[model samples]
Target: MNYSPELVQFLGSLVAILAVAGLAWWMKLGGAPELSNEKEAQAAASEAMDGFESVETAVDANGRGAILRDRSGCLLLLKQHGNKFAGRLLTHSATGRIDKDKLVVDSGERRFGVVALAIDHAQSWADRINEVRSASDA
Candidate 1:
């Protein structure tokens, strides 16, 4: 059977699109990652950054994110970035506020923006974040 040039071009484009989509699905390149437990959060944090050892971890109630604390009392925020997770070491400049069970944190990097996590003891985490700021000022 003979086909027109336009028909051939359309088929070629369709194949390319399907191939790309298949590759993305196979690689899990666009799924929302969640932390199912403290161990998983710690692992993701360590993978996102070098030399991060989480001594304490608080996974979000819904598993949307987590807050990890290293032995040195440094806080790390782990959140979904595309299909993977991104960890940001909460600097002294980082700040957080609590709303009952919710803790909203600002990384202080304008681009990184803010994140609100629902975890146990949100008030304590917010207080701990404040201590980070105070310690820096001291």
Candidate 2:
């Protein structure tokens, strides 16, 4: 069977597109997984900073982010990035505040930007994180 140049080119493009789509699906890079519970958040925080034992954690209501405190009073902020969660240990250069019922945390990394988590008693968490900032400043 004979085919025109245009038809062959179109078929090749379609095949290439399909291959890329299939590869993405196989690699599981399509969506970000939610941080559903404190265990998951704690794990992510530990991965971000080794020896980070979560004494307390507040999971975001929308499952987009989390904030955790270690035994030494250190706070670890977890934010969703791609399919996994990226974390920053809140010490120096970190700030937190409550906007309405949500706790907004800034890691001060600029690129990492800000993360807002809706948790119970957001202000308390915010104050705890600010304490981390204060202690580092002194």
Candidate 3:
């Protein structure tokens, strides 16, 4: 068969376009797994925190203690060094105590010794957490 030069160039261009489109499609499909994984993680987190009217967790920068507070105003103060989240309910404490009075939450793992700093920073960070939860719920 004899092919015209113009026809040959057109077909070559068409093939190149299709190849690029196929690659794009492949990449899009490949990203689906990551999306699904993130969805699953979000779902799990939601479920875990479900049934609580409003919940907030604050951890010290050193990861020593965490306070889990529910909508009812009840708070659970957890302390850990090697024990990890084990602590008695602190019934009495001095007012404005900076060392262990407040709860602080940090994103990454680090040794946080003072719960006061965590509590001081909690309001801003918790606002962000609430925003994320709201968006994820939607």
Can you give the TM-score per candidate against the true fold? 0.77, 0.76, 0.31
As a whole number from 0 to 100, the lDDT of residue 57 in candidate 3 is: 56
User: Candidate 3: global Cα-lDDT?
Assistant: 0.43
lDDT-superior candidate, 1 or 3: 1
Between prediction 2 and prediction 3, which has the larger lDDT?
2
Candidate 2 lDDT over 47-129, as tens digits, reads 98888998899999888889988887878888998878899887678888878778999998999999999999899988888
Better of 1 and 3 by TM-score: 1
Worst 10 residues of 1 by lDDT: 78-87
Query: Candidate 3: misplaced stretches above 4 Å?
Result: 1-54, 92-96, 99-117, 122-138
List, residue by residue over 1-138, the lDDT tens digit for candidate 1: 999999999999999999999998998777777789998988898897888998989998878789999988889998777768887988888999976669999988888878889998898998998899998999
**Per-residue lDDT of 62-111 in model 3, one digit per residue for the tens?**
44444555566433344443422333222222111223444343322234
Candidate 2 is scored at a TM of 0.76
In TM-score terms, candidate 3 sits at: 0.31
